[model samples]
Target: MSVKNKVAIAGVGSSRVGKVPDRTGLGLAAEAAKRAVEDAGIGWDEIDGLLTAYSMTEKYFMLGSVMCEYLGVRPKYAASMVVGGATPGVMLNHAAMAIAAGECSTVLIVIGENRKTGQTRDEAVAALTTVGHPNFENPYGPPMPALYGLVAQRHMYEFGTTSEHLASVAVTARYHASLNPEAQMRTPITVDDVLDSKMIAEPLHLLDCCLISDAAGAIIVTSAERARQLTTSPVYLRGISEFHTHEHVSMAGDLTHTGAEVSGRAAYEMAGVVPGDFDMAMLYDCFTIVPLIELEELGFVARGEAGEFFAEGRARLGGQLPVNTHGGMLSHAHAGAAGGLFDIIEASRQLRGECGERQVNGAELAVVHVEGGVLSSHCTLVLSNSR
Candidate 1:
């Protein structure tokens, strides 16, 4: 019998999201790692490999060296990845492949960034330019919010994607966030308020962009056999795919769309599921326009039809396709790459029905969409809670 390699997420864990204090970067990371290991019913010594999407946020170079020491792990293999939001998802795929190939039996993938304590949201914005292809984009003073606004502008022009529609997204997300105590923007928000909020860039308002907050999240991957013993119910990764548009902002393959199309297609093919199969989706909402475009690319709606996709309440609770039940980056905390890591965590939680007020009803199969680096990189994962 030919055995298929099935990687299972034995644990899903997160640190307190938003404006966390009294904790250093290493302290938060170690707590998350310990929680994940405990959630997996395993010991740190059992981990032979560790993969983290850090360095950019770890900003502290010794993160890996210190994290390992704190976790009581002297792994034979340890490497940090720097793939934006796609970092954790991609590193997970890498760890899964490694486990299946006998490279390692157990691996931990963790990500965290203390933007609040380490740097203010404005400070983070100033540093956003550093993530750019310094030579080409930096000289243009292309602020991250403005860069995303540029995409929003083109999306509206080409696809008839409206500012109101984008406002609907932030409004919807905050509505969900109000149900989540952990969400950063729990205060009641409205589409009218979104429309009236301060404009950051044309077509992009303060509500349209996700908040920058200090946060940490982690996920554990192991072989199917080990997963069976670790948890009563495990969320399995059906498929994983990643793509990068271009190294710089000027090379955005297409402003109206994203490289998510390419990666989304790959993962959907691997998972043998189309848009119709997804009960829920936790799409990366770096900007409101991002998920709007993903709805078109992922076949959730017709191309140029995402404007109307959320129209008539389709993307809301008790609608055709409920989304971002634990709030999203917009209403939740946005911790750089860890933002998407929460997307994955929330997808799993929704699948497990563990989410309190924000839980999606009967979500068995879900998609976690994550993108980073100014819409330059994308990652997609199809996860199922089926045992």
Candidate 2:
């Protein structure tokens, strides 16, 4: 029997994914959690396993216990996942196998963070290393921008990529975000505006970085048979993969390339599809450089061709493969940079014909990529309109 026993994402739900001072982390989770259950046509008591990312927050709360108290169901399998941003995508894969193995009937996966009202962008980056190793990279006091800047510099040097190309990614994503009212940064910007923006680090401008906002998102997944009985448009889980280059950005394997090179290949091989086969894609855009690097690694373009690839306006709106149509983390807000879930949710919306204006026409197949920890880890997922 295949471990991938034909699982499907029955429902996906998210709370207001922006800076809202009205709710706590648990409150946000509850908002998203209720919508997901309603979307799935299930109840709180139906979920057997409760999977959450970062159960221990700065406030130090237990996710499983908290969720149980809020939802009023003590789960059979309850634990917090700490695999960084890749936790949600990878843990979703784990949830599929668990259901196939008859270990659980229904699974709930959630990622929520309250950074907007709590900490500023600079303040959030400072706390990342408290749980990381301080012996080597942390002591340098290098923030995520510095680590990601290293990759941007290498790409510019290797692929002849320009600062203008990076600015284009920012400019376009913000345009899409303007179409999304739920996005944190809804203002539209131009490439010229991005180029003129203030510099955070060398080759990384203020517009190049994703926004830090407070929000939460959740999804309800069940067995394929159950999904068929529940929803008319049961979006299938085609393939999933995860990879890590290194914990600390300083010791990364390659500056120009990323672990997405490996993880992307794994996703294609497992899903039985090529990069060109995808109708749409959601490349994680924590920084402008991430999607550029991932595009090359995923074979959408050549290794040194991402610059030209992006410059052609091919990845923008009405392009061949319109990417991050819901604005992505660039304009969508990065809740601990796990904002990648919004990408996944948007893709699902496009596939299900929910996104009215930003929807890609006939989006039968799509990809959602989420990353966290400054290029240290990534999760790649392929979703298709049914088998």
Candidate 3:
């Protein structure tokens, strides 16, 4: 009778992840949607709901409606979400709620962008700077890295975390990416390489930051009843939670403590599971320090201890918790909000035992967490192969 077990991710799809200058945002989205529809084994017209995020390269009045029309499917419900990296997880929660509320049966969530190929470096930086407050933060001309840099600086100052600790996180992500053929950065890197990389912001080197790529991904959310009838591998949505703390990093109550603290606990409580119950995790790694902070907030490790955890190899594959096995945004392809959806896609694949070399053996339960807008908005999800 629980709605948690009632909704399942029936299918997921992603276009070629790395830079593709020829592909438009809409083209990538269409390709991913087609694959998701085929993977779900559902007719396009059968979809009753559609959800999407805005594209960095393309602007539209109603993106979800535009996407539905572009895909040749009209749905009873359509919505566009914008919450930076947390958009995908938020859309999934909304999709599940729409199904549980009887507003829609099958919901399709899609997002993508040509961030790498669509805009020049200056344009991309300018677009990203818009996330800052125009009145206060934007006047200072601080980019996203500067915002995250502030957090990293504070974390190090308060927790005594060192540059070496941050470098280990980048090393781990690149190592995992080496196993994933579809990953944008596949070459393995070491802590020394991470430290030697050009410094973007204080305490954050080039390797500490995530990649910018052209990518698109789609997901199918349907009732468990429908999912059972369609595919043998159905990843159930066990729990989900979303929260917004502040619009700008300057307005945040505490730079070190993100909304993940509240949302992660809410999601785990809803799913009737704890941190240890998850076999794998797909954390939004916009920066190396992000996963460290998020893992601490999620109670995967004690606060002020994530740096040591990474340094000790606790977050790597075959360790206590394998995080961002698909390399995450740090090593994987990040294309606007769609980059976050890739975390869910990878979690679904892990639960289904679809990841060949990167697969965590017997990974039945997984966690996908993403935060957006200078860690202002947060979303956490718990998924399991078993209901």
Task: Give the top-scoring candidate (TM-score).
Answer: 3
Best by lDDT: 3
Each prediction's RMSD to truth: 2.1, 2.0, 1.1
For 1-387, candidate 1 gives per-residue lDDT tens digits of 111238888887888878788665666677677788888999877998887766444555766665677677888767777777777777877887888888888888777777778876677777876666678878778777888888888887887778889988887788888998888888877778888989988889988888877787787888888887898878888878888877566877678677888988988888878989988888888889888988787779887777676655788878888878778999988877788888888887787778877778788899888877777778888899763
Cα displacement (angstroms), candidate 1, residue 142, comes to 1.4
Screening candidate 1 with a backbone cut-off below 3 angstroms (N, C-alpha, C), the clashing residue pairs are none
The models' CA-based lDDT, in order, is 0.79, 0.79, 0.91
Measured with C-alpha atoms, the lDDT of residue 184 in candidate 1 is 87
Kindly indicate the candidate among 2 and 3 with the higher TM-score: 3
Angstrom error at residue 334, model 1:
1.0
Q: Considering lDDT, which of the candidate structures 1 and 3 is the better prediction for this target?
A: 3
TM-score of 3: 0.98
User: Which digits, one per residue and each the tens of the lDDT, describe model 3 over residues 1-387?
Assistant: 346788999999998888888888988998898899999999998999999998878878888888888899999999998888999999999899889999999999998798888899999988877778889898988888888999999999999989999999999988899999999999999999999999998889999998999999999999998899999999999989988999788799998888998999999988999999989889999998899899999999988899999999988888899999989888989998988999999999999998999889889899899999888999999999999
- Candidate 3 wrongly placed segments (more than 4 Å): none
